[model samples]
Target: MSIEVGSKLQGKVTGITKFGAFVELPGGSTGLVHISEVADNYVKDINEYLTVGDQVTVKVINVEKDGKIGLSIKKAKDNPKPSSNRRKSNTHSKGNQDRTETFEAKMNRFLKDSEDRLATLRKHTESKRGGRGAKKG
Candidate 1:
């Protein structure tokens, strides 16, 4: 089968590297599945997810003019299916929700947090400076 952009196919993992996995498509063509395209979550190590001789379904993201095929396994499995009950609602209503905060309350909270952080940073800097000053004394 000819590989085209957006074409989904099953391929075998021929090799694995730090950057990506080499997959051999049906038409004796090889494609590279980048590390980001291996899974939905962050893949620290590609070997942890796939190894040589593992068969997986991948989508052809790009078939360059120079015959370079870019494959993706994450994009192919990103959207499984949408449920009818999970559809977004259009109704809008205003209920008893506290959206107002007094100026004094806001300032007090902000000042308290800022002061705590500043105190911690000052203590750290002073300790470093004090150590140097003691050596001179």
Candidate 2:
């Protein structure tokens, strides 16, 4: 089988490492599956998802001129898990049935949150430094 970019194929997991996994392609070509490509969510450990000698479907995402191949196991899956950042509609609100936040409102909330975080960080830093401009008694 011709191993080209975007080509999907079944490969065996020959090795697993902290960064990624190595898969042996049909034509004896090996490819590296980066940790980010292992799944849709953050992959703290690759061993949690893949093991040596496991048959996994992979997509050929890149092929270097030096015979290096890059694969993605997440893309090979039919239905990947949705990102955690996608927020669901707020159904608990009783007053606003069809109310949607405007750009200005969202920006206001973001700014407020950022300000709060910065204040907290500044407070912590000041406390650690024994208060700003305080002369040691």
Candidate 3:
């Protein structure tokens, strides 16, 4: 009921929107669960995963001073990795790390890949145009 960060609580889907879903918490406080936090996979349609009046468990990711709460449905689920094994794996993580991709990480990776692809495309097309700064004879 305190609505502290990292707290998992049962909530009801009060409303759904293009961007996210509104969940009513136990204390009657509502929070927005962004579409990206809806699942581990890409969610083009939030309605497919949630609907009004559906019960859901959410994790309190953030609580703003202005009374805004950020919830995450996927994060509310327990991590499959065992703590002891996870710690051991961390020690050898440099060999082959399998980390969960956060939203920011995915965004940065997408931008980087897009820029690389555009650069390659420009280089390819420039050659067809007789290289840079060339004019018609």
User: Model 1 over residues 44-136: C-alpha lDDT tens digits?
Assistant: 999999989999999999988888889999877758432322222211122432346577876886899999999999889889888456665
Candidate 3 similarity to native, TM-score: 0.62
Per-model TM values vs. the true structure = 0.64, 0.78, 0.62
Task: Summarize candidate 2's per-residue lDDT along 1-137 as a digit string, tens digits.
Answer: 67889888999999999999999999898999999999877799899999999999999999999889999999898876555323323434334533467888878878999999999999999999888777566
Clashing residue pairs found in predicted model 3: none
Q: List the candidate 1 regions with Cα displacement exceeding 4 Å.
A: 78-126, 131-137
Q: Local distance difference test, per candidate?
A: 0.83, 0.87, 0.88
lDDT of model 1, residue 60: 97
When superposed on Cα atoms, how far off is each prediction in RMSD? Answer: 8.8, 4.5, 8.2
Ranking by TM-score: 2, 1, 3
Pairs of residues clashing in candidate 1: none
Q: What TM-score does prediction 1 earn?
A: 0.64
| Leading candidate by lDDT | 3
Specify the highest-TM-score model's number: 2
Error of 3 at 130 (Å): 13
lDDT of 3 by residue, 100-121 (tens): 6577976887899999999999
